[model samples]
Target chain A: MSEQGYHVAILGATGAVGTRIIEQLENSNINVASLKPLASKHSAGKTVTFNGQTVEIEEATPESFEGIDIVLASAGGAVSKELLPEAVKRGAVCVDNTSAFRMDENVPLVVPEVNADQLKNHHGIIANPNCSTIQMMVALEPIRRKYGLKQIITSTYQAASGSGQAAIDELIEQVKTYVKGEEMSADIMPVKSDKKHFPLAFNLLPQIDVFEEDGYSHEEWKMIHETKKIMKNDMNDTELKVTATCVRVPVVIGHGESVYFEMDNQDVTADDIKELLSHSPGVIVEDNPAEQLYPQPLTAEGKRETFVGRIRPDKENPGAFNMWIVSDNLLKGAAWNTVQIAEELVKRRLIK
Target chain B: MSEQGYHVAILGATGAVGTRIIEQLENSNINVASLKPLASKHSAGKTVTFNGQTVEIEEATPESFEGIDIVLASAGGAVSKELLPEAVKRGAVCVDNTSAFRMDENVPLVVPEVNADQLKNHHGIIANPNCSTIQMMVALEPIRRKYGLKQIITSTYQAASGSGQAAIDELIEQVKTYVKGEEMSADIMPVKSDKKHFPLAFNLLPQIDVFEEDGYSHEEWKMIHETKKIMKNDMNDTELKVTATCVRVPVVIGHGESVYFEMDNQDVTADDIKELLSHSPGVIVEDNPAEQLYPQPLTAEGKRETFVGRIRPDKENPGAFNMWIVSDNLLKGAAWNTVQIAEELVKRRLIK
Candidate 1:
């Protein structure tokens, strides 16, 4: 695009995921000529580090993407809905980290390991799948590629960081109150505006995001719909079934999922599934039950790779198998995955 | 037995679940002539209160059950196997909370709400199902009875207390270490004897019990086998498929399960499942998404009833539906279930 490398602007640059995007760029091979960190008016003056240099955040506006080559948007859905379109109109490709455009007919919901080819077809905005769905797709992509996938049933142990910085602070405060034997109070969690707020310290909240009319939370529905869209076309097909229970736990960073999948080939054994995952890209198999090793949130924190473990066959069904999937919610689930898609677009020569 | 009532001896009286058993007995309608609180020699002199009377715990020995009419055993498996047969030999009916006798052909694993009739056929021991399985059986029994049951897939968020008082203490200590920015060290978690231990403070552990020859952990296997033995008469039938992924979370008291089940009757609606559980004996339905009402572990703590919520129909399978089940692990899972069986034995005149 210019004599210098690509000029990258990170929307929501002061937020949890946006900061991780900056850190990833420092280690990544992408040649970022200049970093434009954009945030809300409240965080406009804040400085964030990029490639060991402090970059002052600017108040995000429609015209902020004037000369940007790539826009990594992690601002909430409203900001993305209002500002991302202007970025695209200015000839910038946006890899959004929100649900704003995920289900749009023209946008492709991508997990690079699962559907990087979809990047070639992106109409200016390429949507990143939900964190829980992204890790599950990484673990199952190998198995699904080797043996066709039919249905998926998942239960997630998502971390507090997925809700953002305020929720993580709340968990820390609750833990301090619990340690001091004081009454624990909660102001934000399990849908901050919902009638009730539960502490994520030493507890599990089954509700993530808001509840839908059909009784499934928005997080659960996102997993169901996003997986179908990313892994298969024609999501309305009756043959492909995906269901999930998305829950919030006390973990601060990584998200863990207990995933059960039915394969079309009935004879795939647990060992066979493990072998496939070990060989798959962007997936690390940490399964060794004898030594009590598996993918844990603490172990996966700040890491870019998706970890798969606890591989086992469903004794009741020959076609079904179970595995544990974990990844840093701020990394692969959000920021890292967003950066990966941008890299893919550059690699394919699709981006200017 | 005696003029006052049946003589009840509680094994492992000083432990976490054992203490809750004493509390349940305090409010129970069963008339007690005497309360024999038995524990290891180390805790023999500890005093526990029952029905406003302070009872000293005696060292658990084979002779402790000489005149006991009923035995509520919450001691570890080794202690139960060593001393339970001695109690049975002395003519005391035992409701065991350990896994020692659950799989024995003679010992009927009973969840009173699901299979109280199995109590009559028990020779001496009526085994209590694992905490996770008991709550699931209570919620699903009514649905299973109205519409013939087929298959179940579940993932659990179990509390630290399920592992015992030591694990609870470990969780509390780990949380304190985390709050103070101290390096967290763990010695017992996700199975203490396993070579590696992971902190459960702000994280989740996928392995609950030691892994079997296959990749399934002992806890996962227990859920599968115990559910079949409790719900169906001929567990060998290939049609009854039960699979589970058991995980340990940071919660301290209640265990939560996300269950997906298929029924023979394809016409059962979400309302139909909710209506059945609401009227069921030991289940309390709390599914009102509009009001944000669901069964949370914090709300279910110290409660005797199993709370069911988040009832929704699976769109892919006409007969399949999903529900969230929660209960105090010590109460309904172990201590309360054991006490209920003892009460059932009294009500049926099956003891002595």
Candidate 2:
């Protein structure tokens, strides 16, 4: 490996996840020779700090990827659809944080701890799983390897930050209004472009994304599809049954999930599940109930690891179990996952 | 109908839900001969305002029910368990807001919109369903009555107020700390006395109540069990499967749910579901995708009716449908539900 760092470009550099990627890279061991921040025309010319230096955001285009060794894309699906191929075409290895390439046959959707080996088969581009799926997989992968997973049902308590910066601002404003005994207003959040904005400061919103053809919201669909993509290797001829109910809460940063699963084997106890998760990479266990130890979003804010707690066997179903998982949505869910992939690329010598 | 209102007693009169009950009863047409506000010994000397008059808080006791025609109880489960039966024995009709008697076979669980007829069988006590279940049932009951319901899967986005006042205070303090870039402390919420508090200002917490034997939290279990108790015409039939994931969010007031259900009958379109909800009593349908109209917590805050939106069919299951439901947690979820039962008691002329 050369002492000189790799030339890296961050697409969607103005997004919530993009900012985290910059923070992760700032303290990372990876040597960065040059940093390129790219976004839409609206964000072009905006300056972002990287490694203590300001980098001007440029309009993302095919030519912008030339000479870049690794590209981290956190743009939306449409942007990634248009720009990701261009980055790959310019000979840069791409790690996309959008839903565009997650289920693509050629792309490997990876969570470093869960399936770092999948990186070996990536065809120039890798996809990050959905934010909700990423945290669940991080906690469940270790259990799956040890106990063998059969089915998983999860309900997500997602934060406003999962939507974007504007949503976070709206929550703050709404909360202030609530405290001041003033009428609160919400125009963005739980699907901003959606007709009515509800005050999330002191309330909950059930729909996370737009509704698809089926009754499920797009967010719920993402969890269902992304879980399959992440755990694809574990599924044999049988399809992985992943049922999810995704909801948006007043929380601004972290995402929490209540996950229930059935194991192929019944001997695995809740204690065993807790032990496995405690030692799993990038996972923290806080499941002692006597002293009331547990993982919470309040404690998970700004942290990189996924927190697991409340592990117990399902009393009604012999082989079924339940667990709680929490993590900073912007970190492990998006930015940190992308940076971890970048780190793995350096370790595996996948990037020049 | 008596021109003079009955004597009313409010237990846990200063609580989150209790406060809403006072607000609702203020403009109510129900004749009130006298108002008695009862609390614990600690708060016995305190005072709460009711309809422009300062009502002294009296110590809650078995004797407190004397001369009371209707007692609305919102204290903790223990308090309700201890005082409710006493209130009933003393000739006061008890409308309990706690989970104490929800599953008691002798007690008839009521969600007025869904099973107003159940009030006929109440033997001095009527149980209110869980907040999450209440809103979902209100929205789905109309469809279920017409289509013959089969199964339901739901996830809840609950507010801090559901956990009581300490949680609300924690959220406010934490948000202020977060805005100032300072580390915040967590002493309450996501389960008070639980080791390690997380910041609620910008996070999601999956654990609502303490974990039960089958990996489900007590809160989730309540939703599942209460739904059956409220909807089952025959208590012996356990075939009405309802699975729930209950989570606590940073929101302070409204409770939201993402619900999916499959009907015994098919051919029901999302529009049909919307039509059913639109006409349901105590339900307001706001679903319109193109113009971005949908139910949101912010909009639902302070509103008595349950708001339903995002109606769509599940692509995977032909007869299945999905929708979003939101309501003020303190109102319909607790206070309003309790007060409605009291109103029902009068309408039936059940109160002797």
Best by DockQ: 1
DockQ, all models: 0.80, 0.42
CA-based DockQ, model 2 = 0.42
TM-score of chain A of 1: 0.98
* Model 2 CAPRI rating: acceptable
- Cα lDDT listed for each candidate: 0.90, 0.81
- In model 1, the runs with Cα more than 4 Å from the true position are B233-235
Ten residues in a row with the worst lDDT in model 2 chain A?
Answer: A233-242
Over the true interface, candidate 1 deviates by an RMSD, in Å, of 1.0
* Every candidate's TM-score, chain A alone: 0.98, 0.95
**Which candidate number maximizes TM-score?**
1
- The CAPRI quality class of candidate 1 comes to medium
TM-score of chain B of each: 0.98, 0.96
